[model samples]
Target: MKALYQYIKVIIQAFSSLLNGLLLTLKYFLTPGKSIITEQYPENRTTSIRIPERFAGELVLPHNENNEHKCTACTLCQLSCPNGSIEIFSKTIETEDGKKKKILDRWVYHLDMCTFCGQCVDACPSDAIQMKNNFELSAFDRNTLTRQLNRPDSRLEESNKQQKNTLAS
Candidate 1:
């Protein structure tokens, strides 16, 4: 008898909640200012919802004179890379200060492999790495899209670094 009474009570509560929901839904339907907030996909993608300021973005490399990239191949970025996207080749050299220092041999930054976690930027002690807002990174062929920018003798490569340096300076 007690279980039957509890079951009846639950049924009544459930119906009551259902009716209340329907009433509220109907009230919204009948309200003067009520309007649909749904956006049309693709076409309405231009509309903005506020993104936080500290959002991680695409990577940016600092540059120096002679259009060389500013990174000394310190490998701090490589160490901090969560996805192992940045591969560096560095050589030991004697600087003007008469001490052994690591000079950057080559910076192989794989654009396709990056997760854009911004850990590299944060770990870079020389301010060599930064993040930019470039988000459109689609490609037809995956292999064709994995870019190793700043090849040794590429004009576009040097010019790109130089442009960044000029802007920074």
Candidate 2:
């Protein structure tokens, strides 16, 4: 009789679980529109979707109209990158006062290898790097993934230039 009772209890529990699952399905079926949490992706591409500010999309080096940037080529960002995504090439130049100093030549960023961990941005002491909101980073060739962060004609900021000049003098 105890074995029979146990069998009955197991049956009852199975039915209860089935009923709970059915009730959840019915709840969604009854109000399908209200229960939808997913967006129709490609169809809604024309519509603008809001992305949060904190979203880590892509790294960008902000440049002003004067073609100036704040990166001092300290290589902190490159050092902080775990995947070796950042490569900074600097050139030593002679100042107006005949003093030699290192200046940033190119800042190579490998987007394909980047994990979007934001370590490089956090490690940048000069606040030269930041994450931009642009998420559309598709490319046909992998070579396009590797980009130069600094503009070809960009130079250090005027304050940095002045400081370097002072140090040279």
Could you tell me the lDDT of residue 56 within candidate 2? 94
How many residue pairs collide in each prediction?
A: 0, 0
Candidate 1 matches the true fold with a TM-score of 0.56
**RMSDs, each prediction?**
7.6, 5.1
Query: 56-122 in candidate 1: lDDT tens per residue?
Result: 6667675554565656465889998888888877778785879675556767777888888888888
Give a tens-digit lDDT track for model 2, residues 29-106. Answer: 888887566777667855746788999999999998999998888899999999999999999999799978799999
Root mean square deviation (Cα) for candidate 1: 7.6
Worst 10 residues of 2 by lDDT: 160-169
